[model samples]
Target chain A: DTAVSQTPKYLVTQMGNDKSIKCEQNLGHDTMYWYKQDSKKFLKIMFSYNNKELIINETVPNRFSPKSPDKAHLNLHINSLELGDSAVYFCASSQDWGQQGTQYFGPGTRLLVL
Target chain B: QQQVKQSPQSLIVQKGGISIINCAYENTAFDYFPWYQQFPGKGPALLIAIRPDVSEKKEGRFTISFNKSAKQFSLHIMDSQPGDSATYFCAASGRTGANNLFFGTGTRLTVIP
Candidate 1:
């Protein structure tokens, strides 16, 4: 079974168009995260939730909002997407928020804004 | 500012040769260090990891060499095979509520047969 899964493997939209990406993890993990990988392949964390509570919010703009309905699901919604929003979004999950916990990543959703 | 710096944005190695990727960090608070391997069209996967206390950790042909004093660590692939070619990332994180990972730019390794 896939430990972490993401829907809409690819997305292409125009500027000002809003879109959402869904992520789910079946590893029975309590912590889930959203990450953005830019064109240069630099990966950075956007948001993190533990047990349906927001734990980490980076310097991302307000256009990007992450919602976790439960411990297994975390979704990302982008409002009025801009050209700079083009990148790959990855969903990850870990047993918990700890220094030693191993995070498992999903395949990733490739987003392109025109 | 990038907390972790990785060198040689890209590398090419012949089969049966050794592939090495180096990384440096500026945060002394970082206690967990990990190397992630990512293939094309896929997300990064944890390949191996090391802590400040350990000087080295070896798993199969992949080994991580860590130096806490120098605040530097490296990944060495022994007898690298074509299948091992991928983009490798070095990341550091400290114990926090989020435990956010600070990732390096990434080193793309190409193993040629």
Candidate 2:
């Protein structure tokens, strides 16, 4: 079974078009995270949720918002998407919130804005 | 600022040779360090990890050498094979409960037979 899964493996959209990416994990993990990987292969953490509560919010712009309906799902919605929004978004989950457990990542959702 | 810095943005190694990737961090608070391997069209997966307490850890042909005093760590792939070709990332996290990772610019390794 796929431990972590994401929707829309590839997304190609025009500028100012809004879109959303959904992520789900079946590992029964309590913590989930969102990371952005740029064209240069630089990975950075954008947001994190533990048990459906926001835990970490980095310097990302307000155009990007993350919503976690429950412990198993975390979705990202981008408004007024700009050219700079082009990148791969990955969702990861760990066993618990406090412990340093290994994170399992999903096959990323690649987004491209023209 | 980049919390973790990795060297040799790209590397080419002949099969059966050793492949080395180095990384450095300035945050003394970081106690957990992990190396992740990523293939094309896939997300990064944890290859191996080390803590400040251990100087070295090995799993099969992949070994992690950590230097706490120097705040440096390295991944050494012994007898590298063509199947090992992938982008490797070095990351660090502090005592945060959620494990907010600070990743380094990845190293793309191409192993040729």
Candidate 3:
């Protein structure tokens, strides 16, 4: 069984379009995260949710919002996407986001905004 | 500024050789360090990790060396096999409160058999 799973492995949308990416983890973890990997392969944290509550919100644009319906699911919604929004978004989950356990990652959602 | 700096952005090693990737972090608050391996069209998977309290940790063929005072760490893959080829990342996190990781750029290592 895949520990972490994401839907829409590839997405191509135009500017001003709004889209959402779904993520689910079966490890029963309390924390889930959203990371954006840019063209330079730099993975930057976007948002994190612990027990369905917002925990960490990085310096990301306000248009990008992360929502966690429950401990097992976290989804990212991008509004009015721009050209720079093209990148790979990864979903991850960990037991505590600490040293005790590792963060399991999903396949990834490649988004392209034209 | 890159909080965690990684070196030798790319590396090529012969099979049965050692492959090493280095990383340094600026934040002293970081207490946990982890390395991840990623293949094409895939998200990264945790390979190994270390805490500031320990100087070294070895798991299977992958190892992590951490220097607390120097704020440096490195990943070592012993007897690197061609199957081990992948992109590696070094990351750091704080000691308290939802320690979200700050990742390094990445290191692409290719093992030639």
Candidate 4:
């Protein structure tokens, strides 16, 4: 069984279109994270939720919002996407927050805004 | 600020050769360091990790060498095989409340048999 899974492996939309990516983890982890990997292969953390509570919010713009309905699912919604929003979004989950836990990542969703 | 810096953006190695990737961190607060391996069209997977208290760790053909004083760490793959070809990333994280990871650019390793 895949520990972490993501829907819509690829997404292509117009500059002003809005879209959402879904993520789910069966590891029974308490913390889930959303990460963005740019074309340069630089991975940056966008948001993190611990047991459905917002914990980490990076310098990402308000156009991106993360919602966790429960401990097993975390979804990302992009509003009025722009060209800069083109990248790979990965979902990860861990048992807890901190150095003691190891995160497991999903396959990832490639987003393209034209 | 880029907390973790990795070297040799890309590397090529022959079969049975050793592949080394180096990384340095600027944040002293970072207590955990991990190396992740990623294949095309897939998310990265944790290969190995090390803590500040340890100097070296080895798992099968993969090893992690850490230098606490220098705030540096390296991943060494012994007897590299073509199957090991992938992009590797180095990351660091502190014990702060957020515990968010700061990742390095990435190193693409290609082992030609």
User: Which candidate number would show the highest lDDT if scored against the true structure?
Assistant: 2
Q: Which window of ten consecutive residues has the lowest lDDT sum in model 2 chain A?
A: A50-59
What DockQ does each listed candidate score?
0.77, 0.81, 0.69, 0.75
Q: Which fraction of the native contacts appears in each prediction?
A: 0.77, 0.81, 0.72, 0.75
- Of 1 and 2, the candidate ahead on lDDT is 2
Q: What is the C-alpha lDDT profile of model 3 across A49-113, one tens digit per residue?
A: 78635765557999998887777999999999999999999999989754345888999999999
What is the TM-score of candidate 1? 0.97
Q: B1-113 in candidate 2: lDDT tens per residue?
A: 89999998999999999999999999998999999999999999999999999999999999999999999999999999999999999999988657888899999999999
The 10 consecutive residues of candidate 4 chain A with the worst lDDT sum are A49-58
How many Å off is the CA of A17 in candidate 4? 1.1
The digit string of per-residue lDDT tens for model 1 on A6-73 reads: 99999999999989999999999888889999999999988877763675554799998888887789
Which residue runs does candidate 2 get wrong by more than 4 Å?
none
Clashing pairs in model 4, backbone N/Cα/C closer than 3 A: none
Stretches of candidate 1 above 4 Å error? none
Ranking by lDDT: 2, 4, 1, 3
Worst 10 residues of 4 chain B by lDDT: B93-102
Measured with C-alpha atoms, the lDDT of residue B54 in candidate 2 is: 95
> What does candidate 4 score on TM?
0.97
Whole-model Cα lDDT per candidate?
A: 0.91, 0.93, 0.90, 0.92
lDDT of 4 by residue, A8-113 (tens): 8999999999899999999988888999999999999998778635765558999999888888999999999999999999999988865456889999999999
